[model samples]
Target: MLTWAVRMRRTRQFAWLYATTWRVAIPGMIAFPRKPIGITAHGREVVVPSGLLKLLMKVVLGRATQVFAVSRYTRDVMRDRKVISPQTGVVNWNGLSGDAANWHIRSTSSDDNTQLFTICRLVPRKNVRGAIEAIALLRRQNRLGNCRYIIAGRGEDETALRNLVAQHNLEDVIQLVGYRTDEEVTAYFQSTDVFVHPQIVLKDGADFEGFGLVVAEAMSYGIPVIAGRDGGTADFVQNGQNGILVDGHAIPEIADAIEQLVQSPKRRNQLGSSGRHWVSENLSWSKHAKKILVGLSSA
Candidate 1:
């Protein structure tokens, strides 16, 4: 019998031997698998770990019965790294539980002022710092009309983000809220004018936003979104259709998208309406489950 160990005390050689012998080893993450498991060309698995740990994962992934990727981008990265052949993997889009449509009603007519919000772990890949810089650019351009950017959630990058806010003297325009509960997040969505998640692939491509749940959540609440053009967020945003997609690396471009939404409440409402409709129709848990099942069956 093959024993799949999610957690174990073992040396790298032993783990490698076990992986080679096992019929199948499904890892929970492509990054270092603490379960004693688990690349892009810049695959996280290739860049994050070192020495024996990295060597072991390379062997496991190269030999696993099938590799599962959360997004098409991930699957491509695996192929690029030669970790898995094109025919041996599948893409499983993440799904949201419950009826996102029934989550909340659209906020009452937005005023001239805009309340921008983002809910994400403050990590480098999430690029919360870039968003804060964009806010600063807005302030300089005199386009920040009673604009308030509220960032909720905490992470390793929180201190750096807070410093960026303070450095810009934007203590009033940007608020770095600590971690928020799910209920608090829902409330933020209900009140927000636009949601922005400026995610970017890391420099090494070791880390990236596989999928942006916040982008969909805001759309579900009938709020337009401005998201990064890179990674899986494009799977939803249609660039001026359902929402706007911007370059996460370009602070000026991000600021422009925000100002465009702030100045045109009519456009925001239109995109938001379309977004809510599209998300309700395409992002149900049932659809995701069916897709996953089909992939699994074929495998």
Candidate 2:
């Protein structure tokens, strides 16, 4: 990358280096940043790049021409960590796949059961256990109807989550469907009635949702969302507009949010429709690119 930048500059050409992840941007931060460049765009993915990494980022990343964050939560956290200068960074919310808007808006299901879907690596910060606890709470209250919470993804936390399900006698209601294929993912999204991602900040706020793309995808599929209130998801999920935001550590609130949507298909469709429209208007690769390009040119 250093060689490429040098070569371009030697030929009287401008060099614009952009990395989509921290790993990809490290080399540039080490070799360039302070050097000559037309634009240097780096993404902020880590909640906290600790140790030497944290020190290096704090000192070097601010020297870059531009820094783009996937969400406001990510940008603000990095600022709080002193890893990036608040002035040099901009929040570029992740976009939905093209054609997300063209899908036919799904009608509310009249079936007796509702399908609640969640997809993410099984990690403590994801707070999958919180969702399970909410389900257990619902069951205890006899408010949980014929609903199924389908968790799709595999990671270190899976075993514990499964144990929690069994402990609550919720084995029949919760299923951890490990890693899904692209087709299977699409099918799950299509069939989903509500998307649940009660992610929380963990590891002393070192792990969090930078941007909740899956929530947006579910919304694009016309599925209502129920997300935790602690992360970038708040940027996209307006409490009652597009989705409901609940405290990740509170089981009662999560259960109440779930039960509310489960009982009202009309509410589900309303939130889902508004969410899809939000995605079509604000989230797209083109929109993301335009913002970056505009920022670069303006800067």
Candidate 3:
């Protein structure tokens, strides 16, 4: 039955394409493919049809050019699927540009108040609930006072997150400053004490933290991060030295790390400084773009 359904769907797709040849086929055929092109495969796990479509696309599109995967995990997946050969090069994930110098330097001591910031779409896989829970735990123990958490992003889960905040009565402490412009995001990074990314793998085999660009961005601003153990995040965050890596779903561990950073200004400064240095030394977009150009030129 499933086989028949699949065949029927494929037939319908082909029929539609055949019927709309003037509208779809001519334009698709006329477009010239470019080399060193940026192919982003975001959330390739959820949609089987989209994955199949992408696979078919690579069969034709990859013939004359090389491919680059955004994350190491995606690169491995592409390799397993034989989309790109072992000879093809993959670039590690890096963020798009923002105000580079906004948070690169430490401000005066007066601006050092402990504030935790997370910038992500309010989705389940982002583990925003864990961050909120950690804040609640800190507050309950009286370990967190004058500490603020600013979450900047919006999604379908916004209502649920708002409910969780209200249930915990963290309305004042946890502020959901929905969708910020690039400037606003930079401002948050510049002013915040720490950046937290509580990402986690969800059920149905969906994984999160695929080389989180926000974590890297926060690091660029010299903000220490507390990230979950998943995906390619480890490629950037070195636990306990530059940032903290919390074990799976352990709210206590995350809360403890936040509390530790909150109390020790010196440690926070060290971590923040180290993070900035690491980003500068390792993860510049200029370097990645140049490497990509080199690969494409050679290919």
Candidate 4:
């Protein structure tokens, strides 16, 4: 509606359309001028065979001056779908909010308890259940000691997840703390030893993790992370460098990744420090905005 109003009144004064998803891009393409730039976060949405949406994307993407994708993975998908000309598509990674990145930096402790954290909606695609399962595997192996798993956020699969926790008898180890305030989330980052976002693409390939921003947020806080290799996370996590990337669906890999960090505080601190630098250099909001301006200039 707002875009339509802008079109009706400000025809001469065009605006850039930053599409958080393809759904938003659809209307933006229709209501905005072709000269203005467009941004999209994921590729699946553009490639989907929705009758009207596909047609709209094909029209706008083919003619747009340029389109920005949040990750190289997304850029590849757009090319594969022929949504945008390969030369016109650019990969501009998503940036971290200033408040989120600098809220609380974790202090290294040699003898402190390890806190495994993941803050995301309780959804199947998020693979929170996989995290829980990995923790359970650790418990069974007697490898987890003084380690607490914190899974925050609420969604439709909460009850089923709670059931999984109960089944594993991880009630004592896993805390399904539903939803948290911004302050609470910051506190978790500060106190957490390792952050894990084990996300996976669903069987039908309909849903998958996009740019794993929370992993970057955790990295910004100087916390080591274990993430999935499915999406844009690969763009940031340099596997065993800044953070560890694993196959989210593989239980052993997730458990092993956590164990590697937990058993060696020295390794954890090393990765955490490197991750902080990476976030500051590449994922900062200020840097992201500047990059967008540069992209616009070139366009």
Better of 1 and 4 by TM-score: 4
Model 2, span 1-299: residue lDDT tens: 67865664567444455666655666655555544222222223454566777666555555556677777887788778667665657888777766764764444555778999999999988899999999999999899988998999999998899889999999899999999998888888877899999888877877788888888888887789999998889998899999999999998999999999988889998998888888778889888888777766666
Each candidate's lDDT (Cα)? 0.73, 0.79, 0.69, 0.79
Q: Could you report the Cα RMSD, in angstroms, for every candidate shown?
A: 6.5, 2.7, 8.8, 2.6
Error of 3 at 117 (Å): 0.9
Off by over 4 Å in 3: 1-55, 58-64, 80-89, 95-113
Local lDDT at 3 for model 1 = 29
lDDT measured at residue 266 in model 2 versus the true structure, 0 to 100: 91
For residue 106, give model 2's deviation from the true position in Å: 4.8
- Which model, 3 or 4, shows the larger TM-score? 4
Off by over 4 Å in 2: 1-15, 29-47, 103-110
Residue 142 miss distance in model 3 (angstroms): 3.6
- Candidate 3 backbone collisions, by pair: none
lDDT for residue 91 in candidate 3, whole number 0-100: 53
Give the CA lDDT, 0 to 100, for residue 69 in model 4. 76
Tens-digit lDDT track for model 4 on 16-105? 655555455556556655546556546456666568767866776665555677788777766765667767677888887766544568
Using all chains and alpha carbons, the TM-scores for the candidates as numbered come to 0.81, 0.90, 0.77, 0.89
Least well predicted 10-residue stretch by lDDT in candidate 1: 15-24
RMSD (CA, Å), candidate 3 to true, equals 8.8
Per-residue lDDT of model 1, residues 97-136, tens digit only: 7876456855764565688999988889888888888888
Judged by TM-score, which candidate is best? Answer: 2
